[model samples]
Target chain A: MFKTVIRRAGKCAAVAAAGLMMMSAQAAEPIKIGSFLSVTGPASFLGDPELKTLEMYVEKINEEGGVLGRQLELIHYDDVGNASSARNFASRLIRSDQVDIIVGGSTTGATMAAVPLIEQAEVPFISLAGAVVITNPVKKWVFKTPQTDRMAAERILTDMKDRGITKFGLISGTGGFGSSGRTQTLEVAEAMGMEVVADVTYSGSDTDMTAQLTNIRNTSGVEAVLNFGFGQGPAIVTRNYAQLGMELPFYQSHGVASDSFLELAGSSAEGLRLPASPLLVPDSLPNDDPQKEVVQNYKAEYEARWDSKVSTFGAYAYDGLMLAVRAMEEAGSTDPEAVRNALENIQGYVGVTGVFNMSPEDHNGLDPDSFRILEVQNGEWKLID
Target chain B: MLAEFLQYLFTGITIGATYALIALGFTLIYNASHVINFAQGEFLMIGGMATVSLTAMGVPMILAVVLAVILAGILGVALQRFAIAPAKQADVVTLIIITIGASIFIRGIAQVVWGKEYHVMQNFSTDQPIEVFGAVLNSQSLWVLGIGAILVVGLVLFFTKTLIGKAILATSMNKEAARLVGIRTQMVLMLAFMVSALLGSVAGIVVAPITFTSYDIGIILGLKGFVAAAIGGLGSGVGAVVGGLSLGIVEAMAAGYISSDYKDAVAFSMILLVLFFMPRGLFGAKVVERV
Candidate 1:
C-alpha cells in the first residue's frame, strides 16, 4: 500500500511539471522586428522586392521554428519614399510598436533620417541603401548591405589603372545617385593619382546626350570614358557613344547594371565594362567562388517566388534580412544591446550582395572587390575577375 | 569642329520634330476652345505605352500602332464628353485647371496598370545610323521628320479645303456664332480633340525608339511642348514649328558650346528674351477685339 501511494505521488508530480511548462510557454511573447520602407512612390522598385523578400523569409523562418524559440512578428510601415514620413514611422516603431530590431531603409534619405532615433533607442538597424555616408563614420548600432558608390568608383579606377588608362572623361546625370557617384569618383580618382580630363553632366529628363558625349569625344588625351549615371540615361549615353564611333573604352557605374539596361542599350552595350554585383552574372561565376551559389540561389528563388526578374536592389534587402537573423541567432536573445553587439561583431556571413564581416570600426565591412567588373559580350554579361 | 556642330544639329532637329508635333496638338485645342489641354502629354504617353504593351502581347507592330492611336482617340472623346462637357458653363481657366486634374488622374491610372519601368520600342527602320560629314544620324529620325512633314501638310489641307475643317475654324472664331449657323460647336470641339490626340500619339510612337517610353514620360515632354507652343504664339502652326526647332537647336548648341549645365537655363532665357520684346509671342494674333 505504501509503494502504491509513492508511485501515485510521482505521477501527480509529473502532471504538475507538464502544466507549469505549458504555462511558461504561453507566457512568452513573440519577438518583434520593425521595418519602414519606400514600398510605393518613386522608390517602389527598390522597396517592393525588399518587402517581398522580408515577408517570404520571415514566414520561412516561422515555419522552420522561429528564432530564439519564439515567433517573429514583423511590424512594417510604408514611408512612400519621404524622409519626414520615414522619421515618423521610425519613431512609432520604437515608441509604440516596441520592436526589437529594424532591417530596412530603401533610400539614403530615409536611412539617415532614422539613424539618430535608432541609435538613441539602442536598436540594431541594417540599411539597404548604397551610399558611403550611411556607415563610413560608423554609428554604434548601424550596418549596411550594399557596396557604396565610393567602392564602385574605386573598383572601376583600379581596373582602369590595370589597363594603363590614367586619363578618363566623366559624364554623369544630375540626379541624386549620379551626382553623388560623380563626387565619389572625383575623390577616388584624386586619391589614386588619376586625371579626369573631361567632366560634364546631363539633366535627368534630357533625352539626347549626344551633345555632351561629343564634347567628351573631342577632349584631348581622354583615353577612356566613365558614365556615372542611372536609369535610362546611361543607356542613352551608351547608344550615343556607339553612334559617335569613339574607340575609347567605356565604363558605367553600378547604377545601370541590370538586364533591363542591356535591353535598353542593345548592341551598343557590347564591350562596355561596369562594376556590378555578381547577381548580374550568377551563372558565369566559377564553381569555386563563394558568392556563386548564394547569388544563383537568390536569383532563382526570388525570380520563382516573385514571378519577376531579380534586381541588385532586391539583393540588398536579402542581405540585410539575412544579416539581422544571423545577429539575432548569435545573440541567443532578443535583447537590443546584445543584438547590436552581435551585429557589430558578425564575421564572414555569406550573402547575395557579398560576404559581410562587420566590425565596430567598420559598420559596412565590404571591400571594393565585392563589385565584380562585368563586360557585355555577345549580348550577355561575361564575368571578368 | 564641323562634325561636332553637325552632330549637335542632328540631335536638335530630331528632338525638335517631336516637340513641334506635341505643340501642334496644343495649338489645335487652344484654337478650338481657348483652353490649353494639359492632358496633351498624357495622350503621347498613352500612345507609346499602349503600342509597347500591345507588341509585347504578340500583336504585329503596325497593327499595334493603329490600335494604340485608336484607343487614344477614344480617350480624347471621353475627356471632352465626360470631363469637360458636364462643366460647359465653366470659364476657360477653370477648363484648363480641369485638364490638369485629368492628367494627374490619367497618370495615376497608368501607374497602376503598367507599374513604373521604362520600356524600349524598336526603331521603325534599320538600327544602322546614317553618317553625313562625320556626324551620325539615327535612322529613326528620318521616320519622325518624314511623318511630321506629312501631318503638317495634311493639317494645312484639312483646315483649308474640307467643309468640316471650315466648320471647325468657324467654331474657333466664335462658338455662339457658329452654333447659330448650325455648325454644331460641340461636335467640332470633339473632332478637334480626336485629331489632336491622333497627332500626339503618332509623335510619341515615332520618338519612343529615340527617347525610350515610360508612364511618366509625358511630364517633361508635355512641359517642353507647351513652352514651344507659347513661344510660337499659341495658335499659329508655322510659329509652333519655328519655336520648337529653335528651342531644340538652342538647347543643343548651349550644351555643346557653352556647357551642358546651362542647356536648360539658356533655353528658358531665350523665352524670356523673346517675350520681353514681343509680348504676344513671335506670331500671336494682333488685337482686333469685336467690341
Candidate 2:
C-alpha cells in the first residue's frame, strides 16, 4: 500500500511538469510578419522577385534558429497591383491575422494606399516602394527602404548639371509613379537653376512616343531628353528616339533599371543613361564601396536559387527585411513601438542599396549617393564616373 | 513648323494604316455573320507572340510570319465552328457576348503561353529613317503601309471577282435564300472568320515591330478598330480604311497642337458625336423595310 501511494505521487509530478512545458511552448509562439505584394498583376515584375526574396531570407533566418529564439511566421498575400486590394489586405493583416509587423507593396500607388491603414493601426510597416511622399511626412509607425523618386530626380539633375546641360526635354508617362517623378523633377530642376525646354506626356499603353520625341527633337534649346516611366514606356521612348535619329543625350529614371529594358529597347538602349541602385551594376562598383559585397552576394544567391536575374525591386525588399530583422534584434522585443524606435535609430547599416543611416526625421535612410549613374553599353549596364 | 506638321502627318498615316487593317478584319466578319468578334485583337496578339516564339526556335522570319497567319486562320475557323456555330440560334447580342468571352479566354491563354512581358519583332528592313523635307520615316512604316494597301486591294478583288466571295455575300444577305440556292452558308461563315483572322494576324506581324505586342495589346487595338469600323459604316470595306486613317491623322494633329493627354478623349468624343448624329455611320447602308 505504501509503494502504491509513492507511485501515485510520481505520476502527479510528471503531469505537472508536462503542463508547465505546454505553458512555456505557448509563450514561445513565432513572430508573425505579414506581407502583401503585387504578385500577379501589372506590378508582378516587381512583386514576384520581392516575394521570392522575402521567402528565401525568412527560410534562411529560420534555419539559423530564427530571431531571438522565436521562429518567424510569414503571412503573405497577393495585392494584384490594385490600391484597394492592398489596403484591404493590409487591414486584414492588422485586425484579423494580428501580424506583429508588415512588409510589402511593390508600386508607389499600392504602397501609398496602405500607408494610412498601417499608420492608423500603429504597426511597424516597412514599404518597398520608391515614392518620397511615403516618408516625407514621417509617420511614427511607417518606414520605407527604396531610394525615393526625389533622389533619382536630384541625381539626374546633378549629372546633367555636371555635363553643362542647362536645357532639357522631359517626357513622362501618365502613371502614378511617372507623374510623381515628373513633379519631383520639375521641382528639383527649378531649384537647380535648370530649364525644361520641352515637356510632354504619354500613356503607359501608347504604342509609340515619336510624336513626343519629335517635339522634343525640334525644341532648339533642349540639350538632353529625360524619360520617366517604369514599364515599357521608357523603352518605347528609347526606341522612338533612336528611330528619329536624335543627337541629344537621353536619360531615364531609376524605373527602367532592369535588363528587360535592354531587351525591349534592343540596340536603341545603347548610350542611354539612368540613375540606378548599385545593385544593378554590382560588378562595375568599386571594391572599396560597401554596397558591393551586399549587392554581389544577394545577386549571386538570388540568381542561384531562382535561376533568374535579380532586380532593384527585389533588392529593396531584401534591404527592408534585413532592416526589420536588425530592428527586432536591437529592440530585444517584438513590440511595435520598440521596433519603430529601433528602426528610426538604426545607423550605418550596410545594405544592398547603400549604407543606411536612419534617424527620427528620415525613414528611407538613402540619398542621392545611394544611386549610381549607369549607362547601357552593348546591352549591359556600365557604371559611369 | 512645316516639318513638324509633315512629320506628324506621316506618323499618323502609318499608325492609321495598321488601324485600317484591324478595322478591315472587323468589317469582313461583320459582313458575313453580323456578329462582332471581340476576339479580333487576340488574332494580332497570337500572330506577334507566335512569330516571336517561332523565331526563337530558329524559324526563318518569313516562314514564321506565314505560319503565324495560317495558325491564326485555323484557330479562327475553330472558334467559329466550336464556339459560334454551336450556339447559332442565339440572338445577336448573345453572339456578341460570346465573342467577348472568347476574347477574354484567348487573352488568358496567351498570358499563360507567352507570359505577360512585351515581345518585339525585328523590322523587315533597316531601322534608318528616310529623310524627306526635314521629316523622317522609318522603313518599317513603309512596309506597314504597303502590306495594308496590298491586302485591302486583294480583299476588294476577292469579294468582287471570286465565286466563293459572292457566295459569302449571298449568305450574309439572306441565309435561307442562299442555302436554297445551294450555297453552304456554314462554309461561307467559316471562310469569313478565317479571312478576318488572317487579316488581323498580318496586321499584327507587320505593326509589331513599331508598337510592340503583349497579351493585353488586343483590347485597345480592338476598341480603336471597332471605333474605326463604326465610324466608317460597319459593312463597308473602303469606309473602314478611310475612317481609320482619318481618325489617326486627327488624333496625331491634336496631340501635336493641343494636348497629348486629350488625344484619346478627342478621338472618342468624335466617335460619340458621329454616333449621335448619323446612327448608321458615315457610309452605312440606306436600305429600309417597307413596313
Candidate 3:
C-alpha cells in the first residue's frame, strides 16, 4: 500500500514537470517570417538580391538577439516569377507554414496576385513591389516598401514642369511595367494639365524603335520627350533618340536607372534624366541628407556580403525587412494584429528608398519627392537639383 | 516628308538585311535536310556573346570577332555530328524537335556562363549618325548592309563556282543519287551546318551594336529570320532576301504610319495572308510529288 502511494505521487510530479516544460516552450516559440519571391526565372534579377538580403539580415538579426527575444524562422518559397505560382506559394506560407508575418513578392504582378488572400487572412504583409495598385486601396494587412509607378510619373512630370516644358512626346514599352508606367504618366499628365503631343508604344522584343521615335519627333509642339520602358527597350530607345538627333530634352523612367543601362546606351544616355533611388548616388548625396548614412551602410554591407553590385531592387527588400522589424519592435510582440497596426502607424521611418511615413490610409508612406532625379553625364549618374 | 520616308526606309532595310542574313542560314540548312534547325538562333547568340566576352577579356576586336565566328563554326559542326547525326533514322519532324531541345540546352548553358545581362559592342566604324536629306542612319546599319550583301554574294558564288558547294547542292537535290555519284551525304550535311552557322554568327556580330548582345538575343531574331525564310519560299536564296526586306519594310511602315501597338500583329497577319494565298512561300521550289 505504501509503495502504491509513492508511485501515484511520482506520477503527479512528472505531470507537473511536463506542464512546466510546455509553458517554457510556448513562451519561446519562434516568430515565423514567411516569404515568396521570384528567386529564379526572368524576375530573378529582382529576387536574387532580395533573397540574399533577407538571408543575410535574418542571420544578422538572430545573432543580435532576434526580434522580441524570439528567433526569426524564415520560411521561403521560390515563385519563379509566375503570379499563379506566387499565389500558391503564398497560400502555402500562410496555411502550412502558419507564419507570424510575411515579407516578399519580388514583382508587382506577384504582389497584387497574393493581396486578396493576404487581406482575407488578416496577416501582416510587407510587399517589396512597386505598383501603385498594391497599396492604393490600403488593405488592412498589406503594406509595401518600394515607391510606386505613380510617384515616378509625378516626379518626372514635376521636374519637366520645373524646366518649363509642358508639351512632350511619350513612348513606352507594351510590357507590364511599361504599360503601368505609361498609364500612370498619362493620368499624372492629365492631372497636371500638360499636353502629350505624341504617344507611341513598342513591344519588348522590338529591335528598332527608330520609326516610333520619328513619329514623335515629327509632332509639332513637342518640346521634350519622355520614355517609359524597361530592359533593353529603353536602352534601344535612348540609342534611337540620339540617332534621330532630336534636340529636345530626353527623360527616362526609373526602369532604366542603372549602370548597365548607361553601358548599353553608351554615349546616347548622356543628358537623359530619370527618377532614381539615392543609392545610385550614395557618395554624391549631401552629408545632411537623411538617407545618406543608411544608403551607404546598406550598400557596403550588401556588396561585402554578396560580392555583387547593389541594385535598387534589393534595396526594396532591405527597407521592407527593416520596416517589418521596426513594426514588430514597436508593437512589442509578434501578434499579427498588433504588428499590422504598428506597421500602419509607422511614421518618419528613414529607409534607403525614402523616409517612410506610413498611416492607415497610406500603407506606402513614401512621398513623390523621395525619388531624386538623376542625369547621366560622362557615363555616370549625376544627381540633378 | 521625303526625309521621313527615307528614315523609315533606312530603318526597314537595315533590320531587313539582318533578317535576310538569318533567312539565308535557314535556307542553307533546309536545302540540305528537310529538318528546320530551331537552334540556328543559338549560333547567332554564340557569335555575339563570344565576341563581347572576348573583347571584355582584353582581346583585340578583330581577333575577338574571328575567334567568336570560329567558335560558332565549331559549335555548328559539333551540333551536326553529335546531336543531329545520332538520330539518323528519326523523321524530319523529330529532327526538328531535337533541334529545339538542343537550342534550349544551349540557351540554359549560356545563361549560366554569361549571366542574364545585355552587353554592348562598340560600332565597327563610327558612332556618329550619317545624315542624308535630314534622315539619320546609324553607321552600324551601313556595315550590316554591306556585310549582308557580301555574304549573299559569297554564298551565291560558293554554290555555283565551287566543287564542294556543288557536292552540297547535289546532296540537297537527291541523297541516294548523290551517294551513287560518290558524294558523301553526311559530310555535305556537316558542311551545310558549319556554313549556315558561320552566316548566322556574322549576322549576329554586325547587329550586336544595334541590338545589345545577350544570351537569349537570338530567340526573337532567329524566329523572325525563319519567318523571312518562310516568306521567301524556305529553300530559295533570292526569296529569303526579298521576303526579309519586305517584312522589315512593312513593319517599319506599319509602326510609323499606322499603330506601333499593332506592329507585330500586322507583321504576323501579313504572314497569315501570304501563306493563305501561296501555300508554298514566295520563292518555294516547284517540286513535283513523286508518289
Candidate 4:
C-alpha cells in the first residue's frame, strides 16, 4: 500500500511540473502594448477616435499573422485628460503590467507628464498629440506620429502666402497648445515676410469672440485672419467673423478639421483654409498610393462600425499602431531596446498620413510635406492645389 | 471711428445681457440657501440641449423652449432636495465642494447621454445679418438682449409685488424667523432653486442659436456667472444684473483693445481685484453677525 501511494504521488508531481512549465511559457510570450488615453473629458473627442484606431490596427496586425510570430495585446487605461492621472497610468503600465511597448497619449499635457516616467522605464512611447515641445526637449525613447506645431505653422504660413495673404490678424487661446501654436505661427509668418497686423487672445472657455474679431477688423492693413486655437475657440471665431462681415481670407489651425468644428461653426466655416493630413480627405488622394488604400479601408470600416467618418486624431493613432507593429516585426522580438532601435531606424515606411522616414534626430518621422492644404467647401473639406 | 466704437459697444452690451441672465440664476440660489449652486451652468446646458433635442423630434419651437425650461426647473428642485438639503447645515466649504462634485457628475452624465456632440437651436428670426452702425449683428442678438431685459424686469416685479416672491425674500432675509411666522422656509428654498434654473435655462435657450451648445460648456459658464454674481453682490438681484452686464462689457472691451486670448484673464483679474477691495462685493448690504 505504501509503494502504490508513492507511485501515485510521483505521477501527481510530474503533472504539476509540466503545468508550471506551460504557464511560464505563456506568461513571457505575447507582445504587450500599453495605451493611456482620455476616453472621458474635454479631450475625449480626440481620445475616443484614437482608441478606436488603436483597436483597428491591433486587429489588422493579428489577422496578418501577428508580429514576430507572437500576438500583440493592447492594455489601455483612461487618463481622463488630466496630467496627474496620465502619470499614474504610465507608471502602472511600466511597473505592474510590464508591457513590452507603450503607444498613444491624448494630449500634450498628458503626454509630456508621462515622458519622464517612460524614459526611466526605457520603453518606446509614441504620442498622437501635436505640441512641439514634446519633441524639442527630446527624450530618447519618445516617437510621435502627429506633426509638431512648428511643422503645422510653417505649412499654414506657406499656404497663406500662396493665397495672397500678406498682412494677418492672429487670435489664439491662452492654453499651452494654443500659446505654442500661436508663437510658432507668428515666427513662421515673420520668416515668410508676412506682417502680423493684429494679435488677439481668449481663454479656452470664452463663448463670445466678437470683441477680438472687432479688434482684428479694426487693425490697419489686416488682409487675412489666422486663428490658432482648438475646440470651441475656432467655432466662436468663425461665427463672429461672419457676423462682423469680415471678407478677408480666414485660416484655422489644423485642430479645426473635425466633425465637431463643422457642427459648431455651421455655415460660417465655409471657405476656411486649414492644413490637414490626407486622412480627412481620402477621396482626393490617388488610388495607387498605399496610404489611399489603407485610408479607404479604414474609413469604410470606421463608418460601418461607428456610423462616423475618421478624423485626423483617429488617423494619427492608426498610423502610430501600424508603425509600432512594423518596428516589432523588424526588431524580431518584443524587447524594448530592440523596438526603440528599429523605430529610430525606420525608413520609407508608407503610412496613412504620408511616407515616414524616422531618424535618430527626428522623432515625428513626417514634415510639412506630409500635409496638404484643404478648404471647407460647401461644409466639406476639399483639397486645394 | 465713432460708428465702429458704437458698434462694439452695442455688441458688448448684447453679450452682457446674456451674462446678466446667468448671474440672476446664481443670485436667486445664493440668496435663498446661502449656498452657491455650482451646477447652475448645467441647467443652462440642459435647457439648450433639451430644446435642441425636442425641436429635432418635431416639437414646436415654442413648446420645446417651454419644455426645456420646465425640465431644468424640475432638475433644480431634485438637485436641491437630494444633494443640497442633506448637506444644508454642513460648513460653507463642504457645501461648495458638494455642489462642485454635483457639477462634475452632471457634466459626465451629459457626455454619456448627449454623446459629446454640439447642438444648436434655430434662431428666432432668420440667420441673416442686420446692419447696425457699420457693424453686422444677428437678429438673434436683439432677441437675446430683449428677453434678458424683460426677464430682469419681470423678476423685479415678482420679488416686490407678489406674495410668494415676498415670502422668498423674507426667507432669504431670515430663514428661522420666516419659518416661525408660518412660512415653509424649505419650500421657499426649493422655489428659489426652481426659479433660478428656469432663468438659466431661458438664457441658454436664447443663446444656443448664436453660440451653439456642448456638454462641457457648463464649467466656464458657471465660473463666469459666479464672477458676475460676485462682482455685483451675491444677494442683490439688481446687483447681479448690473455685474453680469459689466463683466460682459469689460471682457469684450479687453478683447477689443488688449488681446482676445487674455480676455478671460482680464475678466478674472478684474473679479479678483474687486474681491480684494470690496470683500462684501459691489452692492452687498453690510450685515452685523452676533455670536
Give the alpha carbon lDDT tens digit for every residue of B127-215 in model 3.
99999999999999999999999999999999999999999999989999999999999999999999999999999999999989899
TM-scores, one per candidate: 0.95, 0.96, 0.96, 0.92
**TM score of chain A per candidate:** 0.93, 0.94, 0.93, 0.91
* lDDT (10s digit) by residue, model 1, range A43-64: 8888888998888888878888
Ranking by TM-score: 2, 3, 1, 4
Better structure of 1 and 3 per TM-score: 3
Please write out the lDDT profile of model 3 over residues A61-180, one tens digit for every residue: 989988888878888999999999999999999998999899999999999899889889889999999888999987889999999999999999999999999999999999999999
lDDT of 2 at A371: 89
Candidate 2 or 1, higher TM-score: 2
CA displacement after TM-score superposition, residue B250 of candidate 4 (Å) = 1.2
Question: Which of the CAPRI classes, incorrect, acceptable, medium or high, describes model 1?
Answer: medium
Q: After the best TM-score superposition of candidate 4, give how far the Cα of residue A116 lies from its true spot, in angstroms.
A: 2.3
Residue clash pairs of candidate 2: none
Candidate 2 stretches greater than 4 Å from native? A1-28
Best by lDDT: 3
List TM-scores of chain B, every candidate.
0.98, 0.98, 0.99, 0.96
Q: Candidate 3: what lDDT?
A: 0.93
Tens digits of lDDT, candidate 2, A156-212: 999999999999999999988899999999999999999988989988877878787
User: What is the alpha-carbon RMSD of candidate 2 to the true structure?
Assistant: 2.4
